[model samples]
Target: MVSVRRVLSILFCLLMAGLVSSLAVGYFSADGIQWIDAVRIVLLAASTGWLAWGAAYAFNGLLSLPLKREDKTFELVPTSARTAVLVPVYNEDPVKTFSHVAAMIGSLHALGVAGRFDFAILSDTRDPEVAEKEERWFQRLQLECGAHTDIFYRRREQNTGKKAGNVADFIRTSGALYEYMIVLDADSLMEGATMAEMVRRMDDDPRLGLLQTLPKIVHARSFFGRAMQFSTGYYSPIYTRGLAALQGTAGPFWGHNAIVRTRAFAQSCGLPELSGRPPFGGHILSHDYVEAALLTRNGWTVRVDPDLTGSYEEGPDNVVDFAKRDRRWCQGNLQHGRVMVAPGLKPWSRFVFVQNIMAYVASPLWALFIIASIAAPTLKGVPDYFPEPGLSAVFPRVEQGLALTLLVGVFGLLIGPKLLIVARGAISGVNETFGGTGRALLNTLTEILSTSLLAPIMLMYQCRAVLEVFFGMDGGWPATDREAGSVSLSEAWSASWWISATGLVTLGLAFQFAPEYVGWLLLVAGPQVFAPILIHVSSRSALGTAEAGLFETADDRNPSPVVLRQEAILAHWRGAEASAPAFRPVPEPAFEAADAER
Candidate 1:
């Protein structure tokens, strides 16, 4: 049976959905709607309703502030439990990956709790050269961190199930050595205090299977990167707190930057490879969500601590990189359709799967709505209400006020969460952490403008991703490009040519046939027209983002000790000369010899 809190949360979402859908239907049917308009209305309501549901979380989060429970301080809890800090790597730059490991080890040592944790470098690198680099870097990492720390390195010859498989292999082999495990991505970094605190929390709560930290984006230099960093730092907590309030014991696992109970994970998260081919039915790409569902199914509490500070991760530096990452996520999330109906899953887990699916599915729906609207002028003739049986009127009448209200409501739903989050922060004095009210307000506006312009671009990308996935295209796991860089105009055009073409065609058609709606269409079309410029400029560092006082977070302005340590370690690796020559492709015997030497 569902708890009262869960029931209330579900009802709240449903009520919001109903209200938004009713308003949308009323707006569309004001003129005794054509069939195309009717379909558009339904799609609009669904998309906007999702947005409204999220807004409800932010609002609820605001109200729950005073009632928020305080967490036990980490300093009070003795670090006695054994923890395995698992750093999973694919074919990634070894120097950068190991630097992150070194930073974490250093941070742990500084906390005087290094002995309580062990570090594992689990590699699934297919490239022989990269494998060799990994070996060299592992040696360097040990040398830098000294022999006192328990750091182990292993590489799998056959990359079976990718990351999930890699982790499962470790658990099956050596997971019993530790009481708990902290999973870190190649780019993930966390303060020693934060790591200790997570373990402490798990220790205090025996039923807690997973505890996820809210990782802020760091080292974001590009304009696009800065905007993401700023938004994540400022708004993610409000949204996350709201999710936690509703989720209670059933929270999300973002794969990395989270600690899991070894026994619980080994028991529940040994994912079975779905029966069939790629895309929908192969090895699960998005394994994190499924793992969380499995944990919940087994009655293990999965929680996210929004207030846990000092966890950090890097983001894709450009639009292309972001889309590439999203493509993989899209395939993974879409694949959840198969797991949604699995036996024993909690209702909230099922809803999470549905939400993940809609995150990608909504893009195509939005596209379809836009297309229907564009063609509505030509596709639908004059409405004749009297032609239908039981009709009381002849010509359909348009209600300008109703249409305006619908437009305003939709935009409000889309943009209100950010405003509410900002307001909540100010009210709770959380805005001061983000550099005070004046700075926070300015940053919010900047993020809003930037995100509004980027939204359509993302919509098109998501639509393409969804279509490609449905057509059985698999986005293979690829290492994300975290290096700061800018794309040339030609590169940008190559990536966004479809957007430009769509914008031009959309504007042309609107001007030719639906001149009255051209202003409205421009909101969707204008950004596409300048896609190349937006992509190019946003990827460039010279945008004076810092000078313009655009995207500054408290962490950015005043670096935490762990962040400072990470920066120092990164600099050390970058500045040091290559200790070993680049591994050249050689015969199998030579490779074996190299492996033996290592």
Candidate 2:
């Protein structure tokens, strides 16, 4: 028997799906649709239905917020169980990564519970220069805070399985010493109090295997990044809350900013390499979701707590960077097709895999729908609206009304949840978090316009990603270019030339065959034609102008203590070049002594 939460979630999705399919059928049938038109209708309905289902989750979240239950509070009880704060680093900037570590350590020390936790910098960086820099930064980190905290750094000679492999190595070696492990990305930062509370909650619940917090975006300065930050701050909570409501005990693990029971992870989360080459096989790229599913399969609960604040991370500064990350994620999610059928998985866990797969698959489906629409008119003559001789006679009529209804429904699905969130915020007096009502409205509009312009570009990128993955091309883990300053038009054009060509050819075809759709086609083609301008402008630091207060999030207006501390620490580290000595290896005796003490 399915649980009530699962039943309700399914019913809601089915209801939305039925309505969308009905609307699509009505619109497509009114003008006596051809075979290609039927295919377009089916694709549009499936894609739009998936989107509406998401909006429904956000809506459910808003309704459930008032009734959400609270967890047991952390009141500084004496904790016997130890936690290891695992910071995994790839070929990232060592200075910035160590700065985050220092800030988190300082925050934990301020909480007076720093003694119960140890910090581990697990380095999987293959670059020799980066590895040396990581060692030097580790020395500086220890020299600064080693007196009050336990910090350890280890670098692997070979990064066998990427991050998952690095974490598995830690588990095999030192996981026995810790009851719980808090995993963080190089860019991830969590407040000391929140970390303590998470530990306490885990200690209290033996069944809970993972506690994932909602990590808000911070330190975003570029227009694209700020817009992303604002959206994450304002909209993600509602969606997450809805997800939590539906997930019940089977929540998501985002790989970072989450706590996991060391025992549960070791028992059930040992990942196996799939039987194939890149893209669909080998080491799982998105191992977090699989781990969560495995934990649940082993009867451990995975929970996401949206109410837990102060967990934060940085985002890519521009569209190009975002696409690079998305390409990798696309391959990972698509790879879940293999894991979806793994033994002993819970039903919802399997559904979650399907949801993730659709997230990328829907993009290509939408693109195909549009392409078929553009090519349909050229393939067939105008359909006869009148009924056949044997059928009931109906007046010949175009389905403009039904088509308009479907269009409006799609628009509503895309924008209605946001408007609903705004309305709820106004009613609950939470609009101030968004910099007040007027500013919130303006920023919402700005976000909508900006995302609208970028949607087509992203759609093209995702479609390319899916096609490339299907063609067995793997997007290896590349160091993210987070600090790339303003992108020039030439650079943007070089990256998006194919987009321009596609747009030009699409617009030309629409003009030649389906002249009436030129207006609709512009929505897809115009952005691509001006991709360079949009990319360059959005990537500019000055684009985050304060005149209209666009993209002003709560974290931006009233920064949290942790955020402020992190900024200060980063500034100190970046400024003080003479305070720390160059890289020097710690003696083997010192390492042995630290391990013996543990």
Best candidate according to TM-score: 2
Report the lDDT of model 1 for residue 75.
79
Residue by residue across 1-598, what tens digits does model 2's lDDT show?
Answer: 2267557766766776677778777765555667987788778878877887788788777887564233334467778999999999999989899888877887777768888889999999988899988887788899877876899999998888899999999999999999999999999998888899899889889999999999999887788988899899988988898888888778999999999999999999999899988789899999999999999999999999888888999998888888988998999999999999998899889999999999999999988987887887777676554557777666645567776787787878888888888777777666777788788788888898899999999998899999999999755333433345567777787778888889899899899987767887898899988887898889988443843577888776666666766666666676665455543332334223322321
* Best-fitting candidate, scored by lDDT: 2
In model 2, pairs of residues that clash are none
TM-score between candidate 2 and the true structure: 0.92
Span of ten consecutive residues with least summed lDDT in model 1: 583-592
Judged by whole-model lDDT over C-alpha atoms, candidate 2 comes out at 0.83
lDDT string for model 1 (1-598, tens) is 2265556665766676677667767756755667877788778767776776777677666666554334334573685689999999999998888878877777777667888889999999889999998998788788777565889999998878899999999999999888999999999998887898888899999999999999999888898998999878888877787788888678999999999999999999989889888788979999999999999999999999888887999998788889988999999999999999999999889999999998899888878877777787666766556776886777655556766777787778667778877777777777777778888888888888988898888888888899889999755333433335777777788788888899899899888776657887888899988887888888888347576567888776666666666666666566563443442211234223322321
TM-score against truth, every candidate:
0.90, 0.92
